[model samples]
Target chain A: MRYSGFRVIAEALTGHKGWKPVWRDPAPQAEYDYIIVGGGGHGLATAYYLAKEFKQARIAVLEKGYLGGGNVGRNTTIIRSNYLLEGNEPFYEFSLKLWEGLEQDFNYNAMVSQRGIINLIHTDAQRDAFTRRGNGMILNGADAEMLNRDQVRALYPFLNFDNARFPIKGALMQRRGGTVRHDAVAWGYARGADMRGVDLIQNCEVTGMRIENGRIRGVETSRGFIGAKKVGVAVAGSSSKVMAHAGMRLPIESHVLQAFVSEGLKPFINGVMTFGAGHFYVSQSDKGGLVFGGDIDGYNSYAQRGNLPVIEDVAEGGMALMPAIGRARLLRTWGGIMDMSMDGSPIIDKTHVEGLYFNGGWCYGGFKATPASGWCFAHLLAKDEPHKTATAYRFDRFLKGLMIDEKGQGAQPNLH
Target chain B: MIINHPILGPRDAQEFVYLGDANLMGRPDGMTAGIEAFHDYLYNRDNPAGAHRELWYHEQGDRSWLVVTRNTVTHEILKVEMARDVARAGGRSK
Candidate 1:
């Protein structure tokens, strides 16, 4: 049912029992025209776009667990398009645009907050690099601003600006970059897709792919066999394991990345901020908890838990950046598996298996690229062509030595 | 996590730096192998969820490279061997 102020007032005047389940829990059909594996945010968004934009019918999204049980719920909920590469900036800018119109498009309260995000600068070299990155973002039609040391100090006076070493010099700000209620994204997309007659089947684990003589046929699942003429694999951390069912190996490794949230406090942090000298980024949630995270655990693992060393390192980075949060008790911490690609960028292209597509290798940045990733993947699955912004994400880029190494860290996934 | 270093007996895992799969040590002969082989060696991985044999460098301890066969699911170390020995056993020569 359409939710509006009048409906809410009417329901309030009555017994207030007009609310219903957002999405249906339908059983999987025997066959569908399109089958999307892993009903995370990207998969659900792809199904929604396929039904709404492409006007395709007979779409099914298979989830091993319930929706929002994966990275869609595990991320720290930051979104930004402040990238410096040609292959990445445009795509992320498109995603930022999608984020701006997402709540209206899906008719849900996602709480898309564009408070802004700032990358603190410590060194002159960092300033030069950020200057270049800011130019790149502006060229891609995204907003950017360079804040001097006094301006940053005026904005966030609690920061340790006077540190003898690694003093805060400046900051690169993106006025439109911020966070959204991450789980709401999944629910909104699921409801939109279900409204468009797309089946969302949860608790259906795909065990294997049924490829017949180099062509796609169906998939073997825990429930039973489900036939599909076309299949798109959008599993993030499970990319390697799932694609292996089709006798293909991906240039991806799974590593556990942890995030933390502190106890609730008064409204403090006005925007997302990243430490200049370390890999610590933090933002204050609407509920007042400070949500933050750092580097990956730096090992290959499928487990959704991290060791203590990285925790200590992240806390140290936080303390080094802002000494005021030293006493805030950590409320909880959790981990999510990251599909760290060889070049530290994502891949969204067709595989050698006919009618089977792939979309993964999102490293730690998958949360921010959800909208564009789904839009482009749906375009590919419907039109059999890459989206204009995603033309560089082909699998052959690695074979041709055209890696989109955003951090210029070569082929090391852990470093990225 | 503690790694039973072959020579040092047991060392904190924080003392070592991770370098990913042990398959990286099986470098192909660039003179004979084509770009496909090089690409596979550089990118493709058998990233299993169970036991994974990966390389770790003792940068803070003895600066020795070792291979640790650990379970990715449970983070339990199964065996640890000096990477040099594993390389020699796999028919690598200077």
Candidate 2:
């Protein structure tokens, strides 16, 4: 049950590495040069890059909940750079590259297991889409492969090869994309950022945005007021609420995304496969748990728990993909809110309000884009220009009707 | 094989009705009935990735209720939880 894909991820993030500090936020701060809201993957990664790349210390990240308690901790922990969009392709490729050296670069165990990610294609049209994504990955210099039905069977040999409904047609394989330990990822970035003089303020919710004369002055948090010249809003779920304080509304709706984990068993799945035909994807964790998830909750809600239909549909898909896993027990399940956007892409751009930037609407792949999101968001925060790769993801695209919705899920997946 | 999932593995499926938004990817209404059919009814169109239907789980861990979003034709699952837990938010369309 060994897959080169799984090994690539395992070595990339979690291959035994040297020890490091157990990252913990000391205390809240009264002032900061840069105030970041939300302490999830994007927030922590942004703080890390701000210090590592921009050489800017004295940065503060304020979180409403525990550090990494947001989407970073709740995601299915899959990583891939198989975007077909013009901008998302290279940005995600960069993220995959960043994930490769996370352990060595941060000196923390992130458990990045490159179990390989395959998107199943069920038709000629889907195959074409997969090929386009593969080409995009190649253009971005990331590893991508287009696999036919026979090729897929040769690799796993346990798929529902003949299911007429969602035939095991073809797949787009990215050997570099896989899974990472959610908590270790947060700890790694947090430790690295804090070591560089970044302040991580946990349990401190920013209640208000301070803007004066068309410029950001500080953030009003529950603990105290933290002043900064530049303020970045990284809260994915409560984006509208935070941005509303600044008289701005992003093209995002808060939706719940649920995922499930099956009870641990002997090693079975060595790689990850996404049933692109439906919202089904499966990856076996190091603990032998089969982690599965799909499509966001079909409505807008701040609630963390998701509906049951998605769970049933996802489990049924898992059963079809790997008939042998039918006997495996699912252990527990959880849900997280995502700021799904009109285009099903992230909005990492400078807002009309100077000194106030937005980084939300990650749909379902925020975990994979942590590094690149921060990297580009940092570029924008420093120079105040849309990073070249994230240029199309501008907030204005929603208003202009020039949405980059490759998924064709429309503005909302449910309405579509 | 009997899949033993933490949520779905422990229960015996009870009687349920077929309610489909009957979107582009919905399953035909004339498939089958009963537990196996109910299982398919619950997930077939609301899961797998491209499903567009609503599902209701009548029986839970031990007679509790679970509602879900699912697919019918492909039997792919989307969201599953206690009927009470999935956020009961505003009905306004996003």
**Interface RMSD of the candidates, in order:** 0.6, 15.9
The candidate maximizing TM-score is: 1
Residue B70 CA error for candidate 2 (Å)?
21
* Weakest lDDT window of 10 consecutive positions for candidate 1 chain A: A273-282
The deviation in Å at residue A72 for candidate 2 is: 0.4
DockQ of each: 0.89, 0.03
Error of 2 at A149 (Å): 2.4
Misplaced by over 4 Å in model 2 are A1-21, A413-416, B1-94
Model 2 residue A7 CA deviation (Å) reads: 25
Candidate 2: true contacts recovered, fraction? 0.00
Q: Model 1, range A240-336, lDDT digits (tens) per residue? A: 9999999988899999999999999899899999984777999999999999999999999889999999999999999999899999999999899
In model 1, state the lDDT of residue A100. Answer: 99
* Clash tally, candidates in order: 0, 53
